[model samples]
Target: MPTPDTRRALFARGTWPEASRIAAVLRLETVGGALLLVATALALVWANLPGGTYEEVRELHLGPAALGLDLSLEHWAADGLLAIFFFIAGLELKREFVAGDLRDPRAAALPIAAAVGGMAVPALIYVAVVSASPSAPAGAATGWAIPTATDIAFALGVLAVVGSHLPSALRTFLLTLAVVDDLLAITVIAVFYTSDLAPVPLLLALVPLALFTLAVQRRVRTWWVLLPLALLTWGLVHASGIHATVAGVLLGLVVPVVRSQAAGGPDAGPGLAEHFEHRWRPLSAGFAVPVFALLSAGVVIGGAAGLADALSDPVALGVIAGLVVGKPVGILATTFVLAKLTRAELDPSLRWVDVAGVAVLAGMGFTVSLLIGSLAFGQGTPAAEHVTLGVLLGSTAAALLAGVLLLHRNKVYRAIEAEELVDEDEDGIPDVYQR
Candidate 1:
């Protein structure tokens, strides 16, 4: 066994190029996160307005009925638009594992384990909380997975805002954690939530999926060539009673993460994955996700009393507890135990408190939580309404708490940074080393 001093620490900063790319992505997502909040706020305001217009608009239906494509505006937002979001997530996941920091199994293990613990504990909390409630509706336990997701945009946006001087490792860890969380969330939805599975459409979906895969592998970048194939796959998956978002992940996974050998090897340049991400991420973040939030977030809060009643419901309480309490506890405990067992330490610059704060930040499960809420309890039902309210409350509380903690941590890091700069200046070492 390696001595304690020799054992590598967890959360050490990754390579400079990777950090640079992550920073750029963070910058873009911060704006997307702001838009997400604005859209959600608008939804809440519109839903609570005196008239029932929000519901009517959300229920407005369009599309061809012949292909089973006719769906409500709300359904489109959930099933169609959110597929774009998942596609971006899938691309990120593939890049991370294939070419990013998580390529090494040892490096991947920590975040993967953390993600699992983070998910499992919240599910257990939800189950326990609802099980103990005599008044909990029959299917309340179905929402156990609701708090398991971490909204990458929201969490990263908060970090970018509050932790300007914090270490890059924390940001990297959170991003990786959320990626793994998304994969697990997708799994849970496909396995637990799917009902009335139709094998024929699912089998048929592979035809277009295979064609799309071959085209992308051969470096086909034509939107016209790929778009129809992708749409057909999505439609078939939807008809299979599997969430259409699964098709997005499938499509993203097949995209090349590095340039082909014929194109001068992996080091030649960015690959199709990066190319597609650059092209589609803005659309997914700026349009698809925000529009989905606008359509999904509206819930009628009758008044303070109404809000209180919703809070009092066991299911709502369970979600709040899972997000607010379970996330941090599960994450921190898992990380601590892993560090101990592996005889590893945190990176010199990181502290348990820093991990705690980030763990709390992970509790901001907005987008996927809402999606799962609709799936668990049929959309627009009273149960779903309470769930929306719960998710909002829990996420808001988590963001506020994490904000306060990280802001303080950022100040400390700032002071340390200043001291380092002063030392570097006195020593006459070039500032390029800071990069």
Candidate 2:
């Protein structure tokens, strides 16, 4: 048997959170997901109403203009508040790379492949559909990346409702794939979406970033020291012509994931990353994301004719195809090919059909998709409006389809669960009779 020290060391590896922490985070995200839906609905309704109040609220400029940061309310939500969400994403990415499933090549291979394929196929499908359509705008091709993201909160919330009896491994698979998807989406934002190379601010950003890294590595826990430094880094990054959210990810990654010597041995409770995630996750999910959703998801769907025009638009069709069709095809194909080549078998409780359902669920790209749509085509533009409609329609279709398939799967799993729960006696036998 393993000793207590060994158990402590094992826990210290930080590959995953304690079950309770995961549960807490999931519950919080579920609530956030519901709020996200509410925000999106309100935005849609408010925007489509007769008055122009929604546009005024979204477009109102309020930030300090002197520093060249006077962005509109929507821009602030997209560029400013979204940074908090990215920061939490960065923390999760660091944890996964340092101690989670990604650290294990064997364990991470399938999901990593799935995430890549999922992203790639969607972009290709979008590009193909938009480029081939004569009605597509000149710059419509840039929005190919919009459907490449998978909204974790939204997808998981749907799963919780429709697949309550899904095998535990299926949920793990979805979570891992979504995490990797977020990482890829972040990379896309940094690389493909950046404009105008401002070398000075970009280079200057490193100073604060490096200092932030040093403080966190040395176990400096003071908020005053870190907060200003973080803000400075964000400002420099924003000024550098790079999206400000990249700074959040960089700052998160630099935070030391392992326990320091000052924090006792490996078993001396959670590390700084875990502590920070717990403290910030609620803020990110509850405030940053919902606010962003409210500000971004509101598109004036022009009545029945307008809705028809949007759905028929080449850009919208491309987004719909990319998300609803491409995401699942890419994920399922990649998983199947990799499993065949590697001779790896899935958990006995999971079938390829279950994976397929999860893949379909992954197509529900909401948060990051909307953000990318705004970036690809400036918000409130006709192209942007079409992209918004596509994301909403595509995600809804995927959710409804996945719900049907998963509900059927859930019934099967429930039957199995019932059988497994029959062992009521201490002897591990069904006490069906007094015999």
Candidate 3:
């Protein structure tokens, strides 16, 4: 063991620096998101203004292009810009599954459990609450799932509000849980939520994604090679009528996680996860999410659904209850069950109380939830508007409440040890590529 001074030096570069990095990242995200919230408020005000143009605010496609590529660039923000935001979601998902907290099963268990409970319970509640035709008659059953997601950005932003005292462990927990939440949301889109099935573009995407996977297996690391291939996949997948954002997830899977174990291998260094994150992370967080928030978060009220309608509507209520009530209970309950039965160790640095608090915060499902809304509600009805409002309201509440609760704790680096996850090499098996 090192002496206190030696440990202090370690803390100097790794612990303190890590904490600072987390703080800075969280601050930027929160501030940007708050600005997004403000812009959304302005949009609402503008739409409801006496001579203002809510109809004029409708989405417009870019008929003119700089090159041959078609882009959506009218008034609505969701049409063109949100793709990069989801692309970042894909990248982060890839990283966690690689050499991050999600690398080991024990490390991932709590978040997975919480995520599942958060998803399932909220969905059930949403269905129960919205089993009517007030907003959508035939689509009522499936609409409950609308509010069952957690927004990773908003959750991260909320955690930022608590400042640096927010434990890295908590951050890890939230990130991993959000990945599982996205996975569930994706499944819902592919399965229960789709309108019509189209196979041509999906097949085209599948072919390239398969080839890309083969490239990884052979240890191909050409950024030029992988980059165009991903764009091709994105184009085909979009044309195929599946959610285009999923193309990013499929492409992300083909990207390698950690440095190859062998130095002689083609992918011998910091792997695609780190490479992409280092280069593209800024663009995603800085530009994509902000743009998405600016476009998608705006809602006008004049009983085309008022705030009261969102609060009182069955679809909205189900979403509100599902995210707020279902998420924490599922996380805490399942975590307790699994840990006790298997005798897996809890993080020694944190108390069960801390775990409880973190679970509460995991309900902030803004970004992913919004994306899911676009998928589920975008083409359909008035409840889509109501659902969007409910998502904002629920995510905001979860974030603020969880941040305050998490602040009550002092220690965060819970010393968790697991048995089944042993490896001869120190780095542990990468979870980044699993999905």
lDDT for each residue of candidate 3 in 1-435, tens digit (9 for 90 to 100): 889898878865666686557544634767656656665576556656786464344454554354323544422244335555556666677788777777788878777777887777777777776764375345656565666677776666666666365446767777788877877777777676556657876786787788777876666767687767777776676666666666766666666777777787655777765666555655666666666665666666676447676677676677777778777877788778888887565655446777777777877766667667666666325766777777777877777778777665532321112223223446664332110
Give all candidates' CA lDDT scores. Answer: 0.89, 0.87, 0.66
TM-scores, one per candidate: 0.90, 0.89, 0.78
TM-score, structure 1 vs. true? 0.90
- Candidates by TM-score, descending order: 1, 2, 3
> Quick one: how many clashes does candidate 3 have?
14
Off by over 4 Å in 2: 1-27, 260-267, 421-435
Could you tell me the lDDT of residue 435 within candidate 3?
A: 7
After TM-score superposition, the amount by which residue 186's alpha carbon in candidate 1 deviates from its true location, in angstroms, is: 0.1
TM-score: the better of candidates 1 and 2: 1
- Worst 10-residue lDDT window for candidate 2 reads 426-435
Worst 10 residues of 3 by lDDT: 413-422
* Predicted structure 2: lDDT: 0.87
Give the better candidate number (1 or 3) by TM-score: 1
User: RMSD in angstroms, all models?
Assistant: 10.1, 7.5, 10.0
